[model samples]
Target: MQQGPEGGSKHMYMEVSRQIGRMAAKGARVLEFRCVVSELYIALRTILIASVTSLRCRLQKRMLTKLLNALDAAAELSTTDRLDEVIHNMVEVGKSIGSNSSVEELLAQQNLLVRMLKKMNRLLEEEEACKASCALCSIEFLERIARYVPSSTVPIWKHMKASIINFLAWSDSRVSEHACWLVTTIIDGDWVKQWSENSLEKKKFWKNFFALLQADSLQAQRLLEEMFTFPGSVTLLFSVTDDFNVESTVAKHLCCAIRHKQLNNSNLFPLVSYFSEMVCVLKDNSENESFLCTLRRLVKAFCLATSDDQSPYFSVRNNFALTIGAVDLLRQIDELAKSGIEIYKRKRDFDNGINGGNVNPASGLKQCLVRLIANLTCEHHGNCDLARKLGAVPILLESTKLDCCNLFMTQWAIFALRSMMKEDSGCRDIISSMKPTSDVRLD
Candidate 1:
């Protein structure tokens, strides 16, 4: 084993050469052997590269070190939503890494790491073990790997987006919110520049992007509210109502109505304005098909929540009014019947909000009367004032719809209509003189 003059293992080269010859002599060209050979070559290559003193190696080392630092910071940062910065840094470092690794290789590594970390985090979460540690590890891992490819990698972006989105759907609302926040920050990055140059187009893209998040948060609104806190996050919370993906339920209905009421009472109405503009954008015909659907759902939820609202804040009340400017939104269940949408459902869930028992017979019956008036007049008039001023119509209509049946809801809708309609002479006259056109046929 004569050593080479390069202060290297000269005998090692001889041994390697002899082994290759022996393998060749034995016709060891099987697929398994080839794979082993390939791996060996890669290991040798890495070792050689590490041993060399080159600018590229120096740069690679620096990027790797920076990425590791970012991971560490992500795990330890006490500040809020700081994962954005860590992920951003990781992206820069990942780009440098990608200069060496193929796009496919980088994507593969990123995906593997994300999968592993998610599994680990879930286990930790389930065991009620070191929640903070699990969160830190997961965030750091994602932040580091998320940077391997830019958003311009559409295929990779789709995968990464789904990975993050799945996290948003997690049972732990805090995890989901953090995941959503990460997604928003990443999409806001320069990678979207490839999608469009015009700033308006860019903004529109974000509107749709955020729309996805809006829908997701609504599914777990209460938990989401507790876990994540961003500057305009409150607006995002209400915006979820616009998401059609969320199935309307008694629970969600209550949540939306109650949350808005609470927000208004707490003097957080300025944040409501943040949603007003997006709601308008969502109303745009040119927006994506999904966006339009989401917008419709959001408006429906907003309508349901505000219908029974009694917020005294001028600004909060103004937002409620602004949301109505969209013609389509203004038409649902009629503006006049603000309290009408939930009459039927309300009868069922009244106990949840009221005295832990169903609404008392008197109030319950009045609610039913109110609903009838709101439904018919509001649908026809497109005016909340009609319902407000001539509330008498609601009682009469409920009596008729209920067919003298003892059903409380029917009576409530009618009474509500009469009470709201009586306030305005114009409404009273309209109600009195109104004839049921063919369009008004009883359903």
Candidate 2:
């Protein structure tokens, strides 16, 4: 009985030792046994595939073999959909290989994670043929990975970023939209503490991200629209310029984002500066009326943001001071008003006799001006001497001399002066100065 037990135990130990020897001979490191097995499986696959191809040569063979190994390891974990497990394995392998130094181990770990994530992305893209469902699934997985980023996961951030960015590049419009939605979630999430720790890195990421957006305006627009709904979305909106060939949807989305309080402050400089430039463009004589309408909507949003009681302009010394500070902005408004007046004049000159057949463009422009003035005044009048500081009173006077001037110009003038009179005494004086006087020149 004793002999039988010893013989059976010896045979089992011999079999186990032989299996270990075979694994070692195959260059499988015990610490990275899974990776080695995956690599070996992939190598066999590549060699089998190449044997059927017309291509030849040891160099090509070696390169493909290496690629296959990396690809196989990446595919194995990705196919299993066990991202955490793969991450743990990669960490263990890195630690074992670079055990002599912490820095080396960290670098090794980071490199492996990035490579694995990238390869896995490639595998999924290839296998799913970039279909919508596959892209959605992959994005969900990527988000899961993103959650690990601030911990031991920080090493994987680079890889995670690249994978998502690449997905944006590789997918079709619908798929790209999905990918962008995923990224915006991560960007707007609490992960800021993880990445924002390094100022230089933050700057670098911003620069690169900006460049990427610049390269594809449509994608940028889509991405930006998604970002707008995010908690810090307004910051991204202010960073974009009108010059980006941005889509109308993106512009509208940005408008919505800054409608909130926290967002307005975070994006004040860029938002105001960009909006100023946009106003100038919109007021130009050359712009079509349709564009004007669109611009009006944008202006409405700006007015909304700036008109709040707690607005940045709230502490101004006088009403017109805010207008004066936005002089260039007001200039654009003036140009738009002038354009409307000109249009009215042309219509009046071309039409036959009718009392209001020659109804003034100036009248329409006056409505816009009134709306603008009222909104601004409402926001700043408590602390600002608006009528005197911005010289709006004089402007109102000049706008009222309708009898001597062409009917359209005169109408706008009257409308403007009338609006000023409604505002304050300063406006009343400006209006009275333009009364029909014999000395006044009538061309």
Quantify all predictions' global Cα lDDT against the true fold. 0.43, 0.48
TM-scores, in order shown?
0.33, 0.50
lDDT of 1 by residue, 1-443 (tens): 65333334334445555676778888887885676566556556655654452445455556555545555554554243444544455456545554565455455445444433443333333323324434544544455456556655565454455445445445566665566556544543243323334454434433443444446564344433332232333444344444434322322333454445533343234333533454455324322434433433333433344345343322233443332333222232233234453432233322234455433212232332234234333434434453334344433453445332245555545544554454445656767887765453332
Tell me, what's the RMSD of every candidate?
19.1, 15.7
User: Which candidate number has the best TM-score?
Assistant: 2
Best by lDDT: 2
Model 2, 242-329: lDDT tens per residue?
A: 3333333345555565564324344434444455555556535333544443344444455556556666533322333335434344
What stretches of model 1 exceed 4 Å from their correct place?
A: 1-58, 61-138, 144-150, 165-181, 184-246, 249-443
Clashes, model 1: 48
